[model samples]
Target: MDKFSDMTLFVSIVKNQGLAAAGRELGLSPATVTARLQALEDRYSVKLLNRSTRHISLTDAGAMYHQACLEIIDSVQETENLLQTGTKEVRGSLKISAPRDIGKQFISPLISEFADQYPDVVPYLYLNDNLSNLAESGLDIVIRYGELADSNLISRKLASSRRVLCASPDYLARKGTPITPQDLAHHDCLTMVRSNEELKTWHFQDSEQHNVITVVPKRCSDDGEVIRQWALDGAGIALKSILDVQEDIKQQRLVTLLNGYMKNFNASTSATGADLNVIYMSRQYQPKRIRLFVDYLIERFQQL
Candidate 1:
């Protein structure tokens, strides 16, 4: 038996959760599915599954092998699709998730442009502050900001987004600009609260020295947009991502503060990490739709 075919069949059986179901999907009988599985196992001299009459589960080795099989299958499919068309023909749905502020301000319009370019590709975007599991939520990509943790997911840096401390001119006129990070404690800070936790602390770096300071905020909000708006209305000083406040800074509606004492602190809770990123599960056999979307985003962000 062809090992790749056997691997695909085995994957199908695992996905379907039964030989009978897998057989139905592949147009093979249950006996044939069992025989193929046995042939594969015997060839490897290992038990791939722990099977009961009614259910089955992968052994530890089987789990590892299954992951490899998936990667192999995806690569094959990608190669076949490319060779068959002899051109990049993108068609399929791309499900994506991103932070609310960045998604609304940047990603949304870019996605619209992508749609115009690849009309055959359908896009589904979810914008929220909460992070969702890529596999469980069935997302094709997640565009996020900040330093990323080490994980199985693949992450590519699209751009560097820095967090800026700013307040409206009127707010500064009334309260005066903070001369140092410590002065934030004396000012009426606008804080962002998420997951029921108030983020009252900000970190700063000077040379090789690190300073973490806590502030007292008169205004607290769960929505980042709300905090940004409050800062615009002269409520208090707020920390915001450059992407969200770039236009405001350019227009001089908001004046950046503490530039000298500022640290490139990325406190964003997005799973993909602090710096702007295009995160996905695997790129081995990424579909045309996803590939093009990722490329478009990278290009657009670079221009930004």
Candidate 2:
């Protein structure tokens, strides 16, 4: 029955969500995948999946067996890697996820260089503004900014950037600059809406003291790039990472506002600052490809 082959096919089908998709991944026809799965089921005297034209769902026993298959596959891969690469270089695909803007501007270039150095390894870069679950998504690493909420994932800080409150010179000139956190209510402040219902509130601290204040914005957006663009076009003031606005600020396209009130706070809205982190699931950390990619990222960030 080629038990290991059947198990691999089953796991791939579960991960891909359908026989056709799994078959495509394995370079087999959908009928072949179905036949193999049916064979495995008959041999075990148990149904592993609830199959339909549109979707496939796992039975309770199938779920347990699937997990065991994953562990077995990982162990076998580890053994092969250890025996084949005694002193050889790391070689495998590295899947990474990061925020869209930062990934395009910062991480992509680093990855390009890494790929050049490790020609045998392929990189799968997934860029999105939304947070992705590393374990579920099968990503080797995830780069995130701000404070992390998932304690189960291991994180290593790569770099730091402060959030700055600023506006276009034209906007400040026409609408008078704010001098205090409370004065933001009187200004046309641009807000970032991260999700369907959650808007990013501007947080601030006293320049000389530890007092903090949270201010709601009069204008909002789901895209940080959109808000930054609006800020450049003299639409409203925005609180954004220094990395995004540094070039414009240097060119005098934008002007800093309420300098005395823009203070560091906490993970949610602290003005104090945020650190960019490289995170991964604990179980995959020992893999050669994972370890090499992480070290490469750390080294690149250090140079930056």
Candidate 3:
């Protein structure tokens, strides 16, 4: 008898509580089911099931083996599903949400590439600085930076970037570089206001001690790009992501300040640190388009 077939019969017997019931469900005779189970036991040289007039139960080893068999069966089914649906032409609308800066700088290009690869897939990309609920927003996926608060959404880490304190070379030359967190009070801090009610607070570490300092901004705006541009134009010092300002720093357009004191800040404010993640909802089964897009994003981010 096939080993897999015998294992299936054994599992069905346990689930149905008897060989007769399992045989009825499987459209086989009770004697055939019993024979299959006995063959499996003989192959393993262990008695798997304890039979009684009124009840059936598994031995200790049988329970462990049953769980393993179930997992293997599940994996086989999943693999078959992937093979059958993997190359099916993905034609559908996919809605994605991301923060404004990341959306424009990174996600937009990814979407364009994804659309080109699967021409039938239409993408609706929403870019906003404000927090938007994925389910309520009707999004297929959300690219979030930093910590997330929702426990229901499934998140996959894509990449990581550090938030660093930066200023233009000219601004630093005029104001002088701050060596300590305390010196930020004397500097012209350019703050990025997230929302109407949000306050801009900067975090730093000194001698392994952490501090959260609220800066009285010399210039403030809700737009991150605006503050970043202002810093580039030598208006004031701004805290920004390393990835966002990497080229500028490389070109000496902007210079990092208070390097020893700078630490990662949680952009979402719910957590203490930041991580770039791709979040999606749990379903009975994920569609091909959703899986493909997420895999593509992860691959692209990993390459970066």
Candidate 4:
């Protein structure tokens, strides 16, 4: 039996979740896939999977072996890609995930420009604020903001955007502009919500002081774009990324408030890191397509 071939087949079976599905992916019949799996188990003298009529699951030993197989397969593929000349002419499907507001306003244009430069490469963009499963979703990279909760993934800083406290001129005219962090108690603040829960706490900081203020939410949404729209519509004050609201501030549509107290607040509703980042799983070798895309993003975002 070819152990490497079986390892590839086994990993595909797990990812695809069935023998027939794995067979379809590998261009083999279900019988052939089953035969190869049996050969692998026999060679090792241990059952690697628990199979029923309708489904299959990995055994404890199978889970451990699958991780080792992934590393080995990745190394071999990297070696093969390294031997291929003309890495400069990148060509392949590149899948990426990014936040909705940034993705539409910034990343979509970047992808279009990159595609124009490298017409041979295809791009797929998935927009969501939720953290994605990279390996399971087969994503090449994810552009994230603020602190990452998952420590297993690799992250690189792309750029940083300062946080700002701002309100529309109309709203400030109606409710009065706040001059200090403590004055937020009297204003209606448009808050950000995640998973149906409103994030009511806002953090502010200066050289000598740090203040945490809990405000009543006038409106809230899981989408950052929605919250931004609310602020633009003169709903109430909001803490927002300078990148997202820079044009509005420049146009005087929104007035930045409590500037003296916002030096270190970092725009995140929670006091987490607010640097924009591009993240991916640690790999033995990154494909040229993925590497080129990352470099292109860094170049474009640095200009912003």
Model 1 lDDT at residue 269: 35
| CA shift of 42, model 2, Å | 12
TM-score of each: 0.70, 0.74, 0.67, 0.74
lDDT values for all models: 0.79, 0.75, 0.76, 0.79
Q: Which is better, 2 or 3, measured by lDDT?
A: 3
**lDDT order of candidates, top first:** 4, 1, 3, 2
The residue-by-residue lDDT of candidate 2 on 108-167, one tens digit each, is 999999889888788999876567655345566898777767776788888777778889
Who is ahead in TM-score, 3 or 4?
Answer: 4
Clash counts for all predictions: 7, 6, 0, 0
Per-residue alpha-carbon lDDT of candidate 1 for residues 1-304, written as tens digits (9 for 90 to 100): 6889888898888877788988999999999999999988888899998899998788868766776776677567667767989865676678888877888888989999999988878899888655555533446789876664638678888877667899999999998888888888889888887678887888876655667888887999877778889999999998887778889999999999988644443433343334778888754556667777888899998998
In model 3, what lDDT does residue 166 have? 91
**Candidate 3 lDDT (Cα, whole model)?**
0.76
Ranking by TM-score: 4, 2, 1, 3
Report how far off residue 104 is in candidate 1 (Å): 1.6
Badly placed stretches (over 4 Å) of model 1 are 1-88, 264-274
Q: Write the per-residue lDDT of candidate 3 for residues 157-264, one digit (tens) a residue.
A: 877776788999899889899878778888988886665743457777666678787777888876667778999999988888776778889999999877776465
Worst 10 residues of 1 by lDDT: 264-273
Local accuracy of candidate 4 as per-residue lDDT tens digits, 180-234? 8889889988887766667787878777867888888888777778878889999
Backbone clash tally (model 4): 0
Candidate 3, residue 148: CA error in Å? 2.0
